[model samples]
Target: MSTKTVLITGTSSGIGLATAVAAAQSGWQVIATMRDTAKAGALLAAAEAAGVTVDVRTLDVTDPASVEACLAGLDRLDALVNNAGAGHLGTLERESVEDVRTVMEVNFFGVLHVTKAAMPLLRASKGRVLTVTSVGGVIGQPFNEAYCAAKFAVEGFMESLAPVAATAGVSVSVVEPGAVASEFVSNVGLADNALEQAGPYAPALSAYLDRTRGAFAHAQTPQDVAAQMVELLAAERPAFRVLTSDAARAFAGAKLKDLDGSAVQTLTGTWVA
Candidate 1:
């Protein structure tokens, strides 16, 4: 049988890089893409060490032209992994509306652009679309208003698209990971004096940071999450939603089961309190 082809975005580092390597090692023809090709060194080095091959490409998901150009070169696509996203840490009151829009552009609209472009190829192959969302997508967190909103949007988009996509022989799933040990945290743009600039929200921001630090200190590795992701991609009938860790399951499960929304409100409220 021929090897399946999978295209993954945001492969310069973190989960995208790991998933690219893992998917390739799992016998898939991997197309690993990032906004900047200059940062491909890490992914290249890791792939070499793993004895896996990944086709590195420039695909700025936020740019529709870039998405089109990248997919235009591919003849067949069995899977599309929407892993490209940026993290922002701020409350709406402290941050300008433009900042939130920037986050949405990368995390929300970017997914739509790529998915829409890949739908034709995916439909032809009867393939799947797997998006890497977050536990925040399910449970809102303090000081993560924009980031959480974007993730929540992705979760809803995939959820609503899953049934619709299935009718076209396309599978859709969202992978929710919690506090994975990856560069994703460092990229969140937390200035050195972020708390200092929090003004009246300083104490609350400090508390949220403390809780966040604790959560990440024991975070799961990207490789661990990637292994699970590849398995789902390889499954004959994969689930619509897959949580990458026990912590993620517990964290997202609360919000999933909460009908009144009070439990989630109380729990996430404690993060900032």
Candidate 2:
């Protein structure tokens, strides 16, 4: 098989960075991009040490012009990984509309913008478009309403796009991974809107945030999640969704069961009250 050309977004850190390195090591020409190229020294060094030539560029997924220009840099792209995302921790009622919009712009619309810009190249190569979503995409979680909403939108958008892309000789797959030990948790952003005034559940919300911070104390490494992406990329007939790690698998399975059981409430009690 010919060497694949993969373009991965958010390569400055985390799973995106890991996937870029792994793909490059596997002989795929990598276009590793970060919001700010100046801060990508670690990624660049890691790729270099692995003997894989990674072309680093600046790409803020929320910018349309940037997306077009970045995609133009690549000649024949085979795969596009929509991995640029961030979390805004806060409950839905507490989060401001602007905060939710910002999350959507980066986590959801960012994927759309980058994917739209890269579709032509991917279509030409009969390549694949892989999105790094989360377990939240499949099931709702507390204190992550904004983030989960964005991911859920991604899952719906990609599911709708899959059939069309397949007919056009392109493939779309979503990788929903459980929490991984990346800077995402430590460096996560709180909903600025929620932080302002104390609401009805202010104490509970504060406690939730504190508990969440503690939970990140134990997260899987980015390498494990990246490996799943590589396998998905290499598969000939890849599924629509690839839930990475055991935690992700269990979450997805439970969500599926809940959805199916909802039709037969006599057998299964209420899930969402």
Candidate 3:
């Protein structure tokens, strides 16, 4: 049998990079992609250190042309890991609609584009689609309105697509992770004047930022989360929804059992108070 190929997006850093390296080490022909191949330094170094190799490609997930260009070059795709996403930190009134749209483009629409394009290859190979969503997708958080909304859209899409895709010989699953220690946190794409112009929501924003810092202080490592992803790839029967950590499971569980939505409401309400 030919070596199975797995294509991953946003492989320049964070979970994407870690997963790319780990998957390669596990014998998958990893197609590690990023918007800028110039940023491939760290990924290359990590792969070298792991004594593994990954095919680096440029893929801007927000662009369908790029998605097509990337996938068109691949002959066989055993799996697709939709890890390419951008984070935004702002409330609706505080930010432009365009800002939220950009968030959706990267986090939600990007997933759709890649998944839609990869369905043919995945279906042919009877492969799986694993998306790296956030715990925010399951339980909304303060000051995370835009980011959470995008992730929510993705989770809903994947959940709905799971059974449908299964009929096509393709499997769809989402992995929700809690706070992770990585450049993803620092690169939330929040504007510089955001805090200075926070004005009325300043205190709440401050509180949320502080709380976020605390959570990420003890955040899960990218490597740990990557291991779970590799495990999912190797699983003969992977679940539709998987939480990557005890913290994520516990946090997401709040909303899972909340009938009136009061549980998550009361819980997250305290973050800003």
Candidate 4:
């Protein structure tokens, strides 16, 4: 059996790294792209120790030139995982215009740039396109106005792209995960005075922020999310979206209906309960 080729972005840590290993272990050729090759040292070492070859390249998703350059080297591709994303935590008013723009650049526009470039390869191979979205994508969070906005854009974009891809023999799917045990939230963008300068909804937003941070503290591991990604890769007929855990499933159900039952409980239950 021939190994399928996969191009994944943001493989330095978290879901991206875990998914890279999982796909490679499942007999898929993996190309792991990160903003800094040095940051991917662990991934390279692990792939080497496992005797699975992975092509690690530097790719700044925000840069269209960089995205195009990276895609040019790949002779063929079976899957393109738009897993590169950043979180922005702050009330919309507290976050400056530039900070919001930066979040959109990395989280929304970056995904579009890479997906646009990978479309041709995917169409040619009749492959799949997956995005590591968040529960935030479905339901907006309190302090994460900017982050939620960006993910909402991803969800909307993918929903529209799925039908188009279907006609072309290409599949598009999204993985909506609640809180996952990764450095993604800690390392994402934040305003210098986010805490001091709350938006119009300071009191409510702060409480919401507390709940979100706590949920992330006890979130599921990256491996748990990666397992679902592997299943999507193997499915002959995949759905448009897959929630990573029970929390995710519940969140998706509530979010699609705009339910405001209990964000904290829904976000934390998948891992804790």
CA lDDT of 43 in candidate 3?
100
Backbone clashes, each candidate:
0, 0, 0, 0
Off by over 4 Å in 3: none
Candidate 1 overall lDDT versus native = 0.95
**Local distance difference test values of all predictions, in order:** 0.95, 0.84, 0.92, 0.85
Which regions of candidate 2 fall more than 4 Å away from where they truly are? 191-198, 210-214, 260-273
> Please, what is the TM-score per model?
0.99, 0.89, 0.98, 0.90
Give me the overall lDDT of model 3.
0.92
What lDDT score is found at residue 118 in candidate 4? 95
Order the numbered candidates by lDDT, best leading.
1, 3, 4, 2
Model 3 CA lDDT for position 255: 92
Worst 10-residue lDDT window, candidate 1:
86-95
Question: Against the true structure, whose TM-score is highest?
Answer: 1
C-alpha RMSD by candidate, in order: 0.7, 3.6, 0.9, 3.8
Pairing residues by index, what is the TM-score of model 3?
0.98
Clashing pairs in 4: none
Give the per-residue lDDT of model 3 (tens digit) for 109-173.
Answer: 99999999999999999999999999989888888888999999999999999999999888889
Q: Write the per-residue lDDT of candidate 2 for residues 39-122, one digit (tens) a residue.
A: 898898888888888889889999999998888877898999999899777666665799889999999999999999989998
The predicted structure with the larger lDDT, 1 or 2, is 1
What residue pairs are clashing in model 3? none
* Best-fitting candidate, scored by lDDT: 1
